[model samples]
Target: MSEPWTLHPDRALPADPTVRGIAREVYAATRDLSIVSMHGHVPVEWFAQDSSFGDPAQLFVVPDHYLTRMLVSQGETLPRLGVGSTETEAVEQDPREIWRRFCAGWQHFRGTPTRYWLEHAFVEIFGVTQRPSAATADAIYDQVAARIESPEFRPRALLDTFRIEVIATTDPAWASLEDHTRLAKDGYGDRVLPTFRPDPLLHVDRTTWREEIDLLGRAADVEIGSYETYLAALRVQRQRFVEAGARATDHGHLAADTTPLDDLEARRVFDAALAGAVTAAEAEAFSGHMLFQMAAMSTEDGLVMQLHPGVLRNHATAPFAAFGPDKGYDIPVVTEFTRSLRPILDAFGHHPAFRMIAFTVDEDVYSRELAPLAGVYPALRLGAPWWFLDAPDAMRRFRESATETAGFSNMSGFVDDTRAFCSIPARHDLARRVDAGYLARLVAEHRLDLDEATETAVDLAYRLPLAAYPAPR
Candidate 1:
């Protein structure tokens, strides 16, 4: 039989003896720092309800696209994993069976960040000793299922256990924020905050845009008939989010364009969209204009703007239709930020109240565009490597690329951007380890003193995030 899998204490540290020694010390200093997740996709309801997770499969396999997408890649069906299934399609009802399938395919996750996180949760969080395999699938599932039934495994309880100082949940602009209100009442309001996402409101071409517009109007208690009222509704909702303890607004667009149109042209496009006569070109232009408007609002309201563009969302239409959005079909595209965001940056780049963290999957722009932009602009900060680039090597490459130009302070530290609640600490842990390794190399090279490298590591792990996204006063 194969030996049981075990995580190394110095995992993800530099391989060189000199650098590794420095890395070990650096990693130890920030290993237990309080996690500051300023941007993420965790559901606010999870904290408000403080409910126990259903089972091992429900907690791991079903909801995580990172797990399910890999399973789908290796000849598995979504329904079999307890994901979205049509009425005609048969769905797997047994959580045990789903867990078994996940465990059986354990080897498929080798060399993936998902693999590292799952192992961390298994060994550190759940006390699983045996490595997952077809033979051990049932036993591991029972162990995980039993562990999740404990009160400590519940959402809010896990917050303290994970040492999460602050975690922001992404919520739609039209959201009522009733759950956030409940959390505020429960004294978790400051710890678990909301992030306003206005993608639906900006994209006039979407099929649900009209419905979302009406919902926004009702939620903001505003009468929306024209572009002016639409802006008013968005402003009202943003204020509501701020009142609910939101410190930032999140935007994800296909591109980072922020050119604004004249009032008449903007009104014309809005009227056309309202009349269901807007062309695709017109809609795209309107979306860009809305982004500029969002920036202007951010300057006024002090909500830090976070823009992560350059994704061709729902690349595989078939999977999107079957499983709905965020089922792991979003593919990265070559994103241009310098020319595309001139309008917004030129307007608010030096504004004292304006702040924006720019994120990208396109590493090509790290040194060439984003780093240089952030290095100079007081309002702009380079977001940490995100999505596909959140892995170990990619993260190292990001620091090597951006730190030279943008420097440590100009970076937004690390944003987990995760939907998996349990994976939060694991992701932050990976980031902290990677940053320590990078700083260790600098120390080994004599470019930075040992004390300087340690301070920078602590800043990256804690202080930078707090400074980047300040809580609403």
Candidate 2:
């Protein structure tokens, strides 16, 4: 059996002591940098309520698609983990059993960052001293449960303790952001912010789309009938989010494609899309037009726009039918960002206020498309390699391929991008370690100096995210 370790020097530091010294120093320089989260799917209400967390299984397994997907991939049932409905229907009240099963299979995660992050979370958050297993599950659970019930473990306390300078949560555009507004009204700290994501507005065929669009119109106080009126309503909502303390807008699309259309043709296409009978060509055209308009709106309103395109959502139809949207079944299909994004880039690639962060399901395009695109365009920056590829190995691959072309400045710093709240510290710590390791390799090979590595590491861990996203006014 591979022995459990907290943080072995050999794993993250360079093998050679000289280079490892440099690595250790670089890690130290950035280790305490305040977290600046500009994009993520964490529930906004967490900050609104500022409640205490539950036990480990509910905190880790129930909310994270990353964790649940791995378990499901290994023939472990999601319901057994108490994530979705299927595993919960027959058996009831087995949170401890779920944690026990996860603990027993914890060895399956050996050497994976999930194991590292979970171990780190255990030590740092709950003060657990041993490896997780069926034998240790109940003890760890009771300990963590006790801590989470304490005032120090409440979400707000943890946020302050973690030294998170600013954290942004994604909310659907139709959402009133009343939670965020309420937080502001109560004179809570400005560290919690909202991101306006317009993904639901992208899929017109869903029954929920029309209702949501109408709700957005109501929120923005505009008519929803014509193309012009609909655009005005969306503009109004964007401004409202800004006034309510939004500094960014998020777009989750099937692709990064965008376009600008002439007035009549755009109106006709919009009419078709609004009626929910859009042809494939019309759907693409309308979405493309909306992307361009959203870019223009960003210029007008100063909200940084983020384009996280190319996810094949809910890849398993059966599970989707059985449970719901995010049950860990969504898979990344290969995506194209070159031709797909050419339309938008051709128009606003150099615009000053139209900032963008592009993510991909396709790592193959990192050098050929995204890096080159980000290298030249003042408006564009690369989002961290995401979803399945957010693993340590994949992160290293991203640095090796993209940094040569795009350089570190053209990349946004890491976003935990997690729904599981407790995992935030664990995830960010993993990124820092992984990034330091990558820099150590450069120093070992004589490609860069230790000072350059130190500055780059600090930027990657903290400062760059603030610079890339809007920083207040």
Candidate 3:
């Protein structure tokens, strides 16, 4: 009978009868609140063109690094899973075969957030009633393929069905944002916005730095002959993004250091980097200086600054050379934010116009560093548990660790931070359930009234994100 595949109405609620009842009520109050995905990596072209997604494998397996990485860990090759290669001669696998491999390895995803999200998509989105396995793989695939062919499964229609009020896509600083402009013309402008991501430009040690600089210059219509012109070009690009409805700037540095450098030293390092003579230490110092500069720019422009630090990207070199970045080998490192961010905090921590949300994969810092820092700094807020920590238990640990000091208001509401467009609603729903369980416990213990928990649930699910990353007027 395949265990009778079904989504329990109270799947993530507390097990205790009283707490589960309280959680059910809490969830019902906020379950329908429109999603505010203030930060994510979904490509804007899908929505701009209202593109119909392809088969099940193409829609779910190929673009999601989470699924691909897990399958790779189980000894399945990326190419077999339909992951495209950078090399020109690689062969593409059949979609059905790729999906079969995924389904055959489905048990590997048990107790994983990927499983939760996939199951949600299978049942709620595609109306699948059988558990995915080698036996059910083809049938499930055919069912989803049929559903995807419908007009209701189109990208724009799915967004509407998901009740997504506003979503932001991470875009390069040098991007033309033509897709976003087209969305605006297509009357979906206010619903989808861009977020400025300038990590490549910040790290001068990269071999592609020079080429990226030239592209930035072309994009901003400014000549970048010196450090002054480079900053000018970046400023112009940020203004362009602002005009296109960007409300936030996203930085993904390997560390959270934000020390500033004197202009003379900065210009010297910039010149060396341009000459391809920069050393590792110099590049790190310059990147830190740029982060401080970004804060200053945020203060002037009123765009919320987001820092997601301490990720060691591309842990393996072979896959990177064969494929490309974001192939799911990024690992987390221990992060210390208190002293590292003192320089920026001292400068703009209290600035009214400057708002910064900090995200991390390191849980040790949740209460020890981030919560305390956000607790005192008026300009700082703690971003939701992200990346590897977006799972249910980790989300609960985040609330237990950070809520006492930072409170619900100092936390940015759940940000999906996904490239998989179909996983947005699932991810948000999981967060809402986890939060409801947390709040329900408080009510069960008589620590909070039901009314207060209901309001907080709605705020965490919807209102906080809009306030944290307001749309540019």
The Cα local distance difference test for each model comes to 0.93, 0.79, 0.92
TM-score of each: 0.98, 0.94, 0.98
**Model 2, span 368-416: residue lDDT tens:** 8899999998989998877777778888889998999999999988987
Q: Rank the candidates by lDDT, best first.
A: 1, 3, 2
For model 2 the TM-score comes to: 0.94
The residue-level lDDT of candidate 1 at 93 comes to 95
- On lDDT, the stronger of 2 and 3 is 3
lDDT by residue (tens digit), candidate 1, 214-320: 99999999989999999999999999999999999999999999999999999999999999999999999999999999999998899999999999999888778
Per-residue lDDT tens digits for candidate 3, residues 344-419, read 9999999988999999999999999999999999999999998999999999999999999999899899999998
Candidate 1 ranges with C-alpha deviation above 4 Å: 1-3
The deviation in Å at residue 236 for candidate 2 is 0.8
